[model samples]
Target: MHQVAPDRSWPLFDVAATRRIEQAAQAALPPFTLMQRAGLATARLALAIAPHARRIWIACGPGNNGGDGLEAATHLAAWGKEAVVTLAGDPAALPADAKRAWERLRQAGLDLAPAPPHDCDLCIDALLGIGAARPLQGGLAAAAQAMAGVGRPVLAIDVPSGLHADTGAGLAVRATHTLALLTLKPGLFTAGGRDAAGQVWFDDLEVPAGPEAPCALLAGPPLAQPRLHASHKGSYGDVAVIGGAPGMAGAALLAASAALHAGAGRVYLAPLDPAAARLAPGLPELMLRDWSSLPLPSLAVACGCGGGTAVADVLPQVLPQAASLVLDADALNAVAAQADLQALLRARSQRSLPTVLTPHPLEAARLLGTSTPAVQADRLAAAQALAARYACVVVLKGSGTVIAAPGQPPAINPTGSARLATGGTGDVLAGWIAALLAHGLPAFEAGQAAVFRHGQLADRWPAGEPLVAGALAARAGG
Candidate 1:
């Protein structure tokens, strides 16, 4: 078993794929071998996490997940530890393998208890696993509440009860550590999963993954490419940032500054508000120019960071002309509002022009003609739908930023924290993606790399210092 971290990429399976893998493994192995492995792994990890604990409460449910708990309790009891077991369902109702496990538990001289021991050091939540399709009730609900109120470390088996293994929805058991058996799930790394499963660990039960493809990938850090000694500034290409109407000119300047710091060969600031030029003195490296003066066909453009209502006017020219484009914030809103611009945006894919759309949940909902709650309900589906609809790369920014492209598996970025909740961070990400695009990376790769880096910055931000957008933009390429 190994702990899940962001240092390496991991395949993320949905409920269907995990079920298939489990079935294949069970067919190839001896009867009850998988459950034995899972139980042993759980017992060992529990010991490792709480070595000195005398009392360990194991909450067992009606399914095989409960059997895993029963098997674990037997081991813990044999090891001279106080194993308190609670069964929420009848032993006779359990499946074949689970019935065998229950018999073993009885043979070990352990009996079911009425409720959790009040003084237990650690609680093992095995009430529900991936099969939790409904809300908690009865004994399961009481156990969940007890575990939550205990304020001690709770180790969950397979998955936290009530969380959708694929969608990451539901108010689930908040486990301090979740041991993913057989396969790593996508939900554990995204949405409410991160909060529900605090520290993720994986044990494949000695079974290899089946031929089934992963639904998504937990993205790792990008590989750093060494710059050639003889390379000049022009080798990186140019970036043009257009937006910043009236009072929001700082948004456009932030994008320009980010591109400059992120290694763009030349950064141009094309502000819609004429008075916005005065703000350029702070970032003198950015070349201030009129939006009409830019040669859109030759530049990588990041449009609509704080463009307000003015961004809609420029989409007609930007959609068809820019060599490559990253449409963000207001630009995404503009496309959602105008059917003609949406058609123009879609046409770019037909012409082999690379385009990426970075939309927060609200912007994504607007584009999909749905509510934010609906989009948030299934972020992977929302991102995939947007990518398919626009025929371009889509970066659905949220708790777990998702990057999806046509015909490619979506990637969930695992490197960010709540520090990135500040305003203008999205603008910074837009510029960072523009820089990568300017450096000649493909649209999907650019989005992935930039989002990874953007979140990584927040993850590594100094503890006491506030993580503001300007500082984040300045450190884009770091």
Candidate 2:
């Protein structure tokens, strides 16, 4: 078993694809071979997690998942550990493979009880696997509930019971560690999977997951590109940030600060509010200018961090003239509400100008004419739909932020945490992407790199340090 991390690329298969792989592998292998491998893998992980434990409680359901538990009990008993089992389903009503496993466990003289024993060092949750169509109820519910409060290390087989293998929804057992069988699941990394599964371990049951089309990819760490020794300030490129109306000048300045720190050759801040400060005392490198004075067609533009309603008026000029653009925050809202702006955004593709859209759940919902819940139910579909409809690279931000581009598979970012939930971090991300675009990366590549680095800063932040937006922006591209 291997731990999942962002340093390596991993293919993420949905439920349907994983099921096909399981069926194909079962057919090719000998009878009970997969079950034996699964049980052995589960037993080995349990021992490794709690080697000093004297008692192991294995909860078994009525399906094939139960069979894997039964197989594990036999091995644990042979290894001189006290392996106790609780059955939530009738033995006679079990599936064929499960029935065989039950007979084998019974023949091995292992103790099996109808209810969970009060005392056990560790709990192995084999109550449910990939297929959980309904909510847990009756004895299964009780077992799952008991596992949650057991105050010990819980090793879940395949997946935590009740979690939707594809969507990562539904109530699930809280496992301290999970062993994924056959293939890695997309749900385990996105949605509720991160909290429910804990540290995910992959066993694959010694079976190869064939070449099925994956729904998404677990994005890997970005490659390092060393700067040339002869580089100068002009060696990068110019970036213009247009936003910050009235009271929100800080938002535009945050983006400008981020662009400057992220290696933009020249950074210009064009605040819509006339009373905005002409210079940042702390970051004097940012050049403040009027919105109309900017040479839009000549430089990479990052628009709408705090533009508010004022951004709508400038979209007509910014959308058509900018050589490469990043439309974020209020600009996304403005485009979603106005058909004229939407048409102009779509027209950029015809001119072969690159554009990127960064929207949180609400902004994305506004663009799609749906609710935030609807957009979050299937983040990949929502992101891809937005990218396809607008003909631009889209970054749908939230837990496991998704980056989708037209004609490419979506990627779920593995970095980042709740520390980035502050107010102006999105603005910082916008400027970071704009800086990369100015440094000569494609829209998709720039978004991917910036988003990854943006989250990495939060992940590496000192534990006691408060992660504010300004600090986050300053820490980018390090």
Q: Quick one: best TM-score, which candidate?
A: 1
The sequence of per-residue lDDT tens digits that candidate 1 reaches over residues 1-478 is: 9999999999999999999999998899899999999999999999999999899999988998898999988998999899999988888999888788889998999888887888799999998888887988988898899999888899999998878888787889999999999999988877888889889999999988869899999999998957789999899989999999999998888888899889999999999998877664497688989989999998999999999999999999999999999999999999999999999999999998899999999999999999999998899999999999999999999888999999989999998999999989999999999999999999998999999999999999999999999999999999
lDDT digits (tens) for residues 1-478 of candidate 2: 7888788878888889988998999899889998998898899999999999999999998798888999998899889889889889889999888888889998998657867878899999999988777999999999999987778888888888888777676789988999888888877776777778888888888777777888888888777757899999788899999999988898998998999999999999999888885545367788888889899987789999999899999899999999899999999999999999999999999898999999998999999999988887788889999999999999999888889999998888888999999999999999999999898899988988898889889999999999999999888788
Q: Please list the residue runs of candidate 2 whose C-alpha ends up more than 4 Å from where it truly belongs after superposition.
A: 277-281
Residue 235, candidate 1: Cα error in Å is 0.7
The runs of at least 3 residues in candidate 1 whose Cα sits more than 4 Å from the true structure, single-residue gaps closed, are none
In Å, residue 271's CA in model 2 sits off its true spot by 1.3
Task: State candidate 2's TM-score.
Answer: 0.96
Worst 10 residues of 1 by lDDT: 276-285
lDDT of each: 0.92, 0.89
